[model samples]
Target: WKIEIFFRNLKQNLHIKSFLGTSQNAVEIQIWTALITILLLQYLKRIAKHPWCLSNLTASLRLNTFTKIDLFQWINEPFSPPPDEPEIA
Candidate 1:
């Protein structure tokens, strides 16, 4: 079923094995966060020029999150050189 596959993707791709909180509100927030993350990644996958598997895309983003660069260009050409930084006056 589609729902089963969705949950499997969450577990495997998102690495959400156990809940961090026992309260209903906390659980809801965690699930919502994961859902939003999936949505964003899916959007990236669609827009990216280079063919990207979801897991690899996720890993790449995770590794590059802190690096300063043009996100749109990176999505299309990840291996290309980063954009130049403006010189501080």
Candidate 2:
């Protein structure tokens, strides 16, 4: 079968001795999953903070597919700039 051949080729190409161990493989899988999850969470947080600004800026620069207008206004409304402070005499 193709699956058997694929596994055999993978094992041979990688020069793996045996794929029976549990502890090392489990730890590696957990670490890789955690790293991927952390990266995705950070990305989502950035999107949440300034969806419109980031989307528009990145789109204008051709860095992303989303445009400023494409973002949800309710979620990406621009904050009002702080009022100017009165000058002290």
Candidate 3:
């Protein structure tokens, strides 16, 4: 019962009037769709493994450590320093 309704809705919305002459197009579309699905799955798996890839490091540090100032300084020290600035003559 439900399957019939679902098929009717899918046919109406997808405009699948007739499958008589769509075998070739369907094959090509399915191939591209499968390729896209596989690529997206692999990309997401790689991202999941790297927790620090897009995380808020400062928040994680604060949660793990006792002192806020120490964490702040540790994270900011590199950006605060001028790596190779020469002294004034």
Candidate 4:
């Protein structure tokens, strides 16, 4: 069920359904690209620990691709304050 949702989002966001490739190889490549993109987004979400929905994340990426904005919350790391310096024993 989760995968179905992922594929649906992929088609809607990445337009996989509109793939015009006549060859199996081309179609395979298109799907692979879409999957890789989704996987990257998922990883970003995981690391950032943001509660963003997958489809929404993809849309945000597309919408902000041209602008200089901080997406993914600190370059693939979750938001956290700097650790305290260790005390000398």
Candidate 5:
């Protein structure tokens, strides 16, 4: 039941209802983009082994946009840099 709340929160936070596409194709693109964004967020959360909700992860990424937080590292561990703080800092 709690997971239901997460999905609902994501749907609201993404403003999925504001998509004012006039054509079918435009609507499809909007839907797909939203889904893909959610998927990427989930993937990052899973890779990080994080127990927090999606909102937390999204906020963290947004805040760390300037930092060297590597999303690719979780997807590909070998060639990617370790999930650590930025080297420049």
Candidate 6:
């Protein structure tokens, strides 16, 4: 069924092998978070100029999470260096 495919995608992309909490509310929250994450990633992929596969894009994001670069620019041109800042007066 389509739902099985959806869960498979979540597990493969998000590495969500097990739920973090046993309570129903906690499980729902975790699933919702993962769903939101997938939607956001799909949006980024659609908007990016570069032809990025989903897994690669996800990995690149994880690798660059702390880097100080413009998000749009980085997504469009991941290999390019960040733009230089003007010197402070």
Number of the top TM-score candidate: 6
Which digits, one per residue and each the tens of the lDDT, describe model 3 over residues 1-89? 97676446435433345544468998567546544644543454344433432124423443556633443344444234434556899
- Candidate 4 lDDT, 39-85, residue by residue in tens: 89888777765576766767767776885545554344324543456
Question: Each model's TM-score?
Answer: 0.86, 0.32, 0.31, 0.64, 0.56, 0.90
Between candidates 5 and 6, the one scoring higher on TM-score is 6
**Candidate 5 C-alpha RMSD relative to the actual structure:** 6.7
User: Which stretches of model 4 miss by more than 4 angstroms?
Assistant: 1-6, 74-89
| Candidate 2 lDDT tens digits, 16-61 | 4555447988757754654564454345447655553433443333
Prediction 1 TM-score vs. true:
0.86
lDDT of 1 at 28: 90
**What shift in Å separates residue 63 of candidate 2 from its native position after superposition?**
32
Off by over 4 Å in 3: 1-22, 50-89
Q: What does the lDDT read for residue 70 in candidate 1? A: 79
For each candidate, the alpha-carbon lDDT, in order, equals 0.90, 0.47, 0.46, 0.70, 0.65, 0.92
Instruction: For model 3, state the Cα shift of residue 15 in Å.
Output: 25
What would the per-residue lDDT of candidate 1 be over residues 1-89, giving only the tens digit for each residue? 99889789999898889889999999899889999999999999999998999999998998998988778789899888776788999
Ranking by TM-score: 6, 1, 4, 5, 2, 3
Q: Write the per-residue lDDT of candidate 5 for residues 1-89, one digit (tens) a residue.
A: 87677457656656455557879999778767877898888777776644646676677566667865456553334235555555795
lDDT of 2: 0.47
Give the top-scoring candidate (lDDT). 6
List the lowest-lDDT window of 10 residues for candidate 1: 77-86
Relative to the true structure, candidate 3 has a C-alpha RMSD (angstroms) of 16.3
